[model samples]
Target chain A: MLETINLTKQFNGQVAVSGLHLNIEAGEIYCLLGANGAGKTTTINMLLNVFPPSSGDALIGGLSVTENPLETKKRLTYIPENLALYPNLTGAENLRFFCGLSGLQLGVTEIEGHLKKAGLQPEAMHKRVETYSKGMRQKVGVALAIARSSDVLLLDEPTSGLDPAASNDFARLLELMKDRGAAILMATHDLFRAKETGTRIGIMNRGKLMDELVASDISHSDLEQVYLNHMKS
Target chain B: MMSHLFYFEWLQLRKTWSFRLTALIVPVIIGYSLLLGHQRVQDQHAQIQELLESEQTFYDDLAERRRAIELGESEVEHWFQNPGNPLVLAQFGGSGRYVFLSPKPLAALAAGQSDLFPYYGKIALTNRSAMRDNALENPVMQVAGPFDFAFVLVWLIPLFVITIGYDVLSREKEGGTLALLQSQPVSIQKILLMKVLFRFLVISGIVLLSVLVFGFLLGIPIGSQAVIPVLLAIIAYIAFWFALCVLVNWFSDSSAINAITLVGLWVLFVLIIPSLISLFASNQHPVPSRAMWVTDQRGIQQAVNEERHTFFESWKADHPEEVMDGDTPDFYLIWMQRLLTNEVIQDRVDEATERFNSPREQQVGVISKLRPLSPSMLMHHWMQQVAGTDAQRLQSLDGEMREFQKDWKGYFIPRFRQLKYFSAEEISQIPRLDFD
Candidate 1:
């Protein structure tokens, strides 16, 4: 459902992301593990067509992102590290507004039902997003994906500052989305979450994807060692 | 899709504190300016009404006195006091009609140059001059101008536009919703356009409604089709300012920077460009100072006075019929000499005055040509023109009075020159100042 063929980006002749290839099918969470400036977010941005790729192409559901951005965008949802919604609006309103942009009309009950499924408290759903914690905001982002029934989900460091339980709750939401047949790509520095929640993991260093491994084949400690070694190199 | 964009945009704007403040403040200022404009035009109407009334009374008294004399009810004690005498009817003391420019239907929209030039003037047999009510006073008022609808729309309305639109796109980017919006199917450019257009609609609608409502309450004849051109020009002017805001937003990402840039542009277009254009236009076509015109008028009067005896002798030789052969009143001989000298002086003064005013007319033409550089300036001039309160309209008083003076002289001077007299019944047949 999500693919990149030799995707690369540059800023004033300095490489932000080198030529790279990635593909993730439905019902899988592919986590990109990297240190800061490792070009993980750049990869997600290219796939989202925020800016065109330097040389190669990113495709979603077999449609080229650069060539048909709106067509591909219709099938995806992005939740950045700090997902910013209208601070003056309630979480439910934010969800409804985004859904409206995606051309989906979800009623109040349906919006509430989706928020409930994403583990947002019934009390917080009607409250302004400015009053929401980072973890609670992530739940709203997850609710957007559920309401839209997006085929692809791009997350960039979405759980960096959350408490342990909130991170775990977010992991559970991703798993639920994965089971519902959504291809998820998350960029993170957390090895444990990558090992536990990610169906497959790729460690990146200096704008290059260094290695890929199935989550079940690697222990949390080994994944940490691999990430640390990649960073050192 | 556009409806959805408008609805959401309105919702967001209403929630914003700045927008809420603007919603309340803008209408108040606009309404107040309209009220001031109404009052200004009302004052002009009052002046015209006063002059017309004074003229009617002056003529009625003359007719009554002449009727009594013809009925053999009273004896004429003095020639100067005789009602049937043409010099008495034309020039004794405030005897001629006062001609004035009436206010147009949309006069309440802009005071314009009405306060800087006379709209009414008196026409006598030998002299015509502008009569001022409240024109050309303090220099400060000239710089500040009248507090009218034109000032509000051309100068203050853009501030509201900038306040609302300066951060239309930058807010979304700075708030970090841009990333999420980018992931949506819509382009940011579309969103930017939508936001700017929405702001333009809000500001324009509020101002238009305010002007209409205030104009209605003030009985300003807003129902007249004459207001349509001014209304359309107003909208176009507001759009010009909004377009500038959009242009500023396109290049800047920070709301502060966008606001500063838009304000800088507003200063350039509204305040600086018009001032510079005025300065440049003045340089292109220089008009002599009002002081110079005054000195020239005094010089003409002195030159004409020095040749007054020669001019009277020439007049006596040219028209022998106007001279009484024998037993004429000494008062008649003295008044006839004064009348002939006044006509000669008036002719020379009119020529000098034309020379003085032609450059001023050219200066106004140059300014009009340069108005396109600043939309605010162009819009202000348009509003004034529609209101009949522009510099050209006010300056036209001299010409209108001159024309009316010809008619005044035509009616009374020929009769006075030929020693013709008629009874009170012909008083109504005398020319009355009529303006459509």
Candidate 2:
């Protein structure tokens, strides 16, 4: 489970993320939809403890990210928007290195299995990440989340640069992870994918969560309408 | 976790062509430096051997002449050529021995100031100046300096270190791997440490292996008392460069910036700062010119020659016992007067030499005190000390040789004053120079 209690962030007396409270339970995919400076990335950065909040807290698996960063970090995994990996290392090697950091010692066969489950082609498993496309690099990011087996996954713009087919493949991968009872928070701008994949959604504007909706209660156009309404005001 | 980090760094370095090239080239440079130093040591040894052979021949001829005179086989034409004459024996026999400075066992490693200084002195009844006999070397070659182990360790090794370490962090940050790495559970500081340590180990291993191989090939005793200090100095110098890399990496976020900053620091410490210090020391305590000293010595010699006739007659009147068969006008009086006048001139020469050398000694003293400001200077001093090629050690040896020259002259002055001819047995009993 992941939760934020009135989570807020400020830079030099100006608010970047202010008074945000949310909960993501097991098997839940909460999609945060927002404009460029809407604090979606800031929200995720707080959850990752990239920096401490001004006066709020994020909890991963019931542990405060600020108070018990290492413990909470061990239970969660993060993938930045630009998913940069060691270019000289193969996909499997990158996976092995990151997995080793999380204290998971997986063998070669198990590593390849995680890569396969993340929708990466078996042929690309042994190729260096320098030759990887943006979509291929995202597959390695998904593989890292799977290899760590973390209960909480925080992803920042995971589908921004992918083709429709690759986006759909990534949406299915998230569905598979959700089915495994992992609580996920994904920040993205694609309304269709958000409506299709998220169990619930939050629309953000200028460092505040302006609205929330259940994905099943609204159609894709309806969610887009709600998002635009928040953005306009 | 540490081992996993090291393995990752090792894998990356193994694939880096620049790193591979540096690893290959450093040893070849070291071997070439060792060869050059060995050649220098061999040249010095050959000169010493030649001097010893010439002295031996002189001794053998003198012994043969004394035997002929004892058997009454030939009549000598002139007192100057007769081995029986004390004046001839003192002037031409083994009394004019060559005082050779043999190379230290580990001298081939550093060369140091040995190329600029003389390793031999021709000691006779007159005072010998070590600096005046500077081994007839080409001035241009002296200016270019020798490519020796000290040059490699003090100047070139830092470049190799910078090449290996300058991008240890900045490259990862630039490629975006740093974010991914920081996202992991490990702290970024530990990861950087592991990366730098991995490179340090690789470079240090190569340097140590080169030193050991050269030590064996050049026959330097690796187990001697100087070995540990030399090794410690090398390790300290390597550590200093690595520490500089760490400081540069901390403030830089781009590989190009890190490289430029590190190379700048290398020039400051290795080349610029030491040169500045040397220039400052020389200006603060300037040595007098040797040319002026030579001019003063010549004037003193000319003055003594002008009074030579009166000086001999006064000495003959004072030491009437040494005058034999007054009608013959014994030539021993002339030789005694020459020896006395030469001793007075030697005193004046010693005073001028001291005045000329004081500022140089002061300059060296100032530089030695300032050496810790740059590790390169410290390593240069340490290496020279270890090899026994530094100016201080050579100066001490020269002092000992001067003392021995005095003892040699003292042993024969009384024989000349008593007008005694040396027998073959007596010639063999002359005080021989023993420098170990």
Candidate 3:
């Protein structure tokens, strides 16, 4: 589980994320909805401990992200929106490299299994990622997350620019991960996918979280209207 | 953990064809350049041999002419008409005691001082004047230095190190994977250590292997006794560059910035520092003015010319048995005057030369003290010394040549005094100059 208690981030005299509060419990998928520069990525970056929080703290499993970052990192896996990996390596090889860095020693068979579970094709498993499609590359990133055995997955726009079929596959994969006890905190712009896949949704605008609601609290038909209204005010 | 990092480095090299190409090509380029340099030095050694042979011939011709003159022959004057005679060209080779230097094993690795300094020189007999430098070389080429192994190791290898390793951590930041990578269970410190170790191994391996190959190919003499010091120097030189790379990498996380800064460091420590030091050292330790000594000594001869009648009168006054009616022989007086004039010229020139070379020695001393600041320079200087290309080595040669020049004068002056010659055995007895 992860939590950001009054988390704040400032850059060059401007508040990028201000006084934000959130909690992600075990097996829960919390989608942070926002427009461009709505502090969604900033919140994720702070929570991931990429940069120090300006005024507050990001906590992972009760450990402060700033003071105990390595411990916090051990419990989490991050997949950036534009996941840059060694394109010269095969998808399976990239997974193995990251897994090895995290102190895991997966054999050839295990590496293949993780790749397949991430929805990578059998033929593409051995092919260099430089020749991979965006969807395929994202699957490799997901494979690395799975390989790390992390309890929390921080995904930045995991389904952005994915075709419908690939996006659906991604949502199913998230569900599978959630069932496996890995809490997911995904920052995304796809409201409809949020309604379809996320357990809870939070709307954010101008560095502040406007509202959080359970999927059951909002009707699917009116979710867009509610999200629009939240954005306007 | 070390092995893992090394494996990843190997994998990265395999994956990136460009990096592999650079690593492979750089060493070959460096080694071949050194090969060409060695060949050049060998050629110079051959030329020195030919010069020595010609010097022998000149001496033989001088002795033959002097013997003929003693035999009471007038037709033998034609031998003195040619400029190729030792009596004519003997002084052209500087007045110094000559010492010959043989190449050492590590000469191939650095060729440090050897390229700039002449291998042969004549050390002065009296230390009156500075020994004539007269190294067998083109001066401009000496300044530029040869494209040798020292050049490759000191300057070019660092460039390769920067190109391959400077972006080790920075690329992750640029690609947005730094955060992700850091999120793993690995310690950042451990990761950095592994990266640096991998680079060190790769570069050091390349350098060591190339040097080993050159040693075998060039056949530089090292009979197990002197090999360790040579190898140790090579390793220390390589480590200097490796440590520099680590320090520079720690300061910047941008590959571009790292490359530029590292190159700047290379230029500063390797190229700029040595050159500036050389310049300041020369200014501080200035060489004595040989031309001015020649002028001053020539003035002494002019004084001798004015007092010629007085010298003849004095000789007649001392040697009554050889004088008829107190009139000394014209030939004997002329020979005495030539000998006395030669002595004055030698003394004045030697004094001025001593003044000129004093600064050069001081400059060398100052440059030597700067060795700790730049190990490459130390290695370079040592290697050149070993290869007989150092100026000091040439100075030693000059020292020998000066002794030989004195011998030339001694052999002729005594015979001229006795007024005797014409034995073929005596013609062959004239001492020939040896390079060593």
Show where candidate 2 strays beyond 4 Å. B68-77, B84-90, B93-95, B127-144, B309-330
Error of 1 at A98 (Å): 0.6
Q: Each candidate's DockQ score against the native complex?
A: 0.77, 0.69, 0.43
Model 3 misplaced regions, further than 4 Å: A5-21, A52-64, A206-208, B40-99, B109-118, B121-143, B221-340, B358-379, B386-388, B403-436
Tens-digit per-residue lDDT, A1-233, candidate 2? 99999999999988999999999998999999999999999998888777899988999888998888778888777877889988888999989988988888889999999999998899999998889988888888888888887798888999998899988998998998898888999999989989999999999998999999999999988898889999999
Tens-place lDDT per residue, model 1, B1-436, is 5676787788678888779878898889888988888887778788778777888888888899899999899889877778888888887787877878898878888889888787787877766878776766778877888788888888888898888888888888899998888899887677667777888999889888887888888898878888787778878888888888777777889999988888888898889999998787678778788898889888988888788888778888997877767776676667677777777778877887788877777777878888888888888888888888888887777878878887787788777766677579787568776675
List TM-score per model, in order: 0.95, 0.93, 0.77
Query: Where is model 2 chain A poorest over a 10-residue stretch in terms of lDDT?
Result: A69-78
Distance from true position, residue A20, model 3, in Å?
A: 4.4
Q: Looking at candidate 2, what is the lDDT of residue B345?
A: 75
lDDT of candidate 3 over B1-436, digit per residue (tens) = 6676677667776666547866688768766966776676666567667756765675566556555655656344443342323333233333223345545444554455554455554433233233224333677657666677666766677677666666766766676666666666677778767877776777677767766676567665444556667667667776777677667766777778877887888888888888788787778777667686677767766776677667667765786655434454465566566555556556656676677677777888987776657665776776666554566655565565566668766655455455443254555654555544
Interface root-mean-square deviation, candidate 1: 0.9
Chain A vs. native, model 1, TM-score: 0.98
Report the candidate with higher TM-score, 1 versus 2.
Answer: 1
TM-score, B chain, candidate 2? 0.91
Q: Interface RMSD (C-alpha) of each candidate?
A: 0.9, 1.2, 1.7
- Worst lDDT 10-window in candidate 2 chain B: B127-136
TM-score of chain B of 1: 0.95
